[model samples]
Target: MENKKANKLIDKILENLDKTGINTETLIDDIKELRTYALEEQIPLVVKVLRYTYEHIEENNSFLIPTLDDEPLDEEGDVIEEEADSPVESLKYLLSLIKNLKNKVNISDLKEYRDLLKAY
Candidate 1:
């Protein structure tokens, strides 16, 4: 079924995201494939997020820069900055956002996230 295919693709994407070195090209292709299913399922939020992720990786050769709040706070309450962008962390954050939207797509929250993503 369509859901089964979509779930399989999602699993594959999650696994790739967790890998030590991700192939950006492959990941982008996979995301594009998943977007088709999301479109068919009428999940506009997922579609939009996936499209953004695809475009971001294609253009930047890296994941989107996560929001500052997504950064960890050190004991001194300062943000723990990374010398370079962490694609894994950003991808995981994207997945978390998708998961949250899957349960219930809140219009206000969606707008907020859209703005946040656009700011990047």
Candidate 2:
């Protein structure tokens, strides 16, 4: 079943998160597979996040990790440049977002958006 397949993929992803070094290519492939499930399930938020994350990683070769502060100063008082997240950190962050997605998105709102798109 699709649910079983999705669960297997999620388990794989979670396992990878615990490893010392993550294989990004495999992770990306897993994400793509999961995105298909999201599309079939009509979970717009998951679909969008997965698509955007995939495109971003593919196009930029890096994940967009936001900095905690707009301008961070060291003890010397000079502004510190923000550092990019490692692939593993990026994966973890993505997983967290996906896990909390239900709380953040309303299914009714997504349905309304879909309806609006159909009207156009």
Candidate 3:
């Protein structure tokens, strides 16, 4: 029951968006179902999405920056590559995304990811 409700709610949220116009009406019913389930279940649906968003953000932010190369660029013009994503900066970006979503997620929610980034 909870799964069905959650699925419906998530569907509704997706459907109501302009990007989801194709299945708009279908999602509407699911969204209503999800809302009822959320109210009865006392589950924070946004929290789950927030967690996923944060993880995805962290992955996207982890990239190679071509600055720490041991040798200068050759005739090909390829620079040295070094890992990017400074921990503090990454955390800031994650916080910004969460802020942009108008959702409140505490730093502790991403503590493990932050710690891993810090190690980098």
Clashing residue pairs for model 3: none
For 13-65, candidate 2 gives per-residue lDDT tens digits of 87876783455687678789988987887777668767766666666555544
Cα lDDT for residue 64, model 3? 19
* Structural RMSD, model 3: 13.8
Model 2 TM-score is 0.57
Over 62-119, each residue of candidate 3 has an lDDT whose tens digit, in order, gives 2211112135576789886555645334433433332222233433434434444344
The residue-by-residue lDDT of candidate 1 on 12-57, one tens digit each, is 8888888744578788898899889889988877788778777877
Query: Sort by lDDT, best first: what order?
Result: 1, 2, 3
Error of 3 at 20 (Å): 4.8
Candidate 1: where is the Cα deviation over 4 Å? 67-85, 99-113
Clashes of 2: 0
User: Cα miss at 14, model 3 (Å)?
Assistant: 3.9
- What candidate 2 gets wrong by more than 4 Å, as runs, is 1-4, 20-22, 67-85, 105-120
**Which candidate order results from sorting by TM-score in descending order?**
1, 2, 3
Worst 10 residues of 2 by lDDT: 111-120
